[model samples]
Target: MATPLAALAADSAGDVAHLIETALTPVFMLSGVGTLLNLLNTRSARVADQIEKASDLLDTEQDKEAKRKLRHHLRRLTRRIMVLDISIMFGGLAGAMTCGAAFVLFLGSVRDASIALWLVALFGAALLSTVAALAAFLCDCFFSWDNLRKSGPLPKSVKKRSPESSASTTG
Candidate 1:
């Protein structure tokens, strides 16, 4: 019986080259998933920071309306965090599935056998997971944008006529 190394040696250069090329596709996809996870993590961190800041303010705030607003804002930020967590989880799953597919592909090549079933299952799952992740990310984006638009402070309007004194500035 030939050793695994010998089996590899027996493979034609073209076959090896093709295997590498095939593997590269999923590797590239894995890289994209990594980048997406990084983005999600960063956004989650920002949301956490906002929660911390809001919590701090709520602790010291004496005004009931302001405290209530801060609590509402905290709830929104918490929702954002949950959505991002979903995205990150799905993204990580996709990355793992992609890696599994690549591994199966490589092994199938060395064994010189078709891995159609495993390849399709793994790759398809990876794609589906990626779609789920994208959907979650999109939802998070929409909610966050809407929240910002709703809560955004209005720009100070330029006074067409200035007051005589500091009243204009204060007003």
Candidate 2:
């Protein structure tokens, strides 16, 4: 009886270790999602800033062509912001589900409970949400790049020129 009990204890410890290993993948995924969220948020802030600048220009501009261009820019910026927001939301969801799955995995291991189906469902949801977030991010990037191509290259102020080059141009 003592031998059997000791063997069972060893098996349970091994099972817990396996569960921890399995949970590690989602932990890494959560970190990736966090990084992506930070990137998306930064991009969103940039788009918002562009929108503000365009709005100011639109208000003061008299030329019809210039106003039209500003309007187009504002439209594209608005769409990009929306897409980025959605992506952030989905990424957050993925992170939450991944955390839940990790918790459930540990809980099941400690309790010696069968939770394979629950684990699968949680991971599936997390993966699907992650995919949606990535898709939204891609769409946002496309919108930004397409607008840039339409508008031609960036302005001279955005381009970096060496001191010598600037002095020559001024002369």
Candidate 3:
């Protein structure tokens, strides 16, 4: 077995930075996609709510049919938001894995220098960015669920909740 000290050796600073840069790619791509989806969903939900409200003034069969279609579209959008949330979270995991592999490689090459310090800083920043992406994903998931719940009817049990009610009292 390779000793721990031997495993940490690196040959060059450029090599370590290359590893870090490679790890950063997937992290930024995944998180950027997630953020864009979140923005799109939020804008869509707002437009949907406005349309729904305006639709109440409409009384024709044609009007009702159009509203129904709009509602269906909104439901689909909500599901898409949820899926994006999940995808982003998985992407963050992938980013972490890539960064870990690069770090391990850096350590094994053992050519420690200013490049080593730069790689360490880069690794830390990448980890932080991945974590932020995870947080955004979770927030978006909750937002999607809340929007979906509000856009439709609630079960009687949920409807009956008093202002002071708690989950224990209901569930």
84-158, model 3: which lDDT tens digit per residue? 555455555545654564665455444533454555565565556556656655665676576667664311111
Off by over 4 Å in 3: 1-114, 153-171
The residue pairs in collision within model 3 are 7-108, 8-107, 9-108, 9-109, 9-110, 10-109, 10-110, 10-111, 11-109
Collision count for each candidate, in order: 0, 0, 9
The whole-model lDDT of each prediction reads 0.85, 0.81, 0.53
Which parts of model 2 are misplaced by more than 4 Å? Answer: 1-9, 12-16, 153-171
RMSD (CA, angstroms), candidate 1: 6.4
Task: Write model 1 residue lDDT over 56-154, tens digit each, in one string.
Answer: 878777677777778788888899899999999999999999999999988886686789899999999999999999999999999889888998521
Model 1 is weakest, by summed lDDT over 10 consecutive residues, at 153-162
- Among these predicted structures, which one has the highest lDDT? 1
Specify the poorest-scoring 10-residue window by lDDT in model 3.
Answer: 153-162
Against the true structure, candidate 1 reaches a TM-score of 0.81
TM-score for each candidate, following the candidate numbering: 0.81, 0.79, 0.37
Q: How many backbone clashes can be found in candidate 3?
A: 9
Model 3 Cα displacement at 26 (Å)?
14
Q: Global CA lDDT of candidate 3, please? A: 0.53
What lDDT would candidate 1 get against the real structure? 0.85
Kindly report which residue stretches of model 1 are placed more than 4 angstroms away from their true locations once superposed: 1-17, 153-171
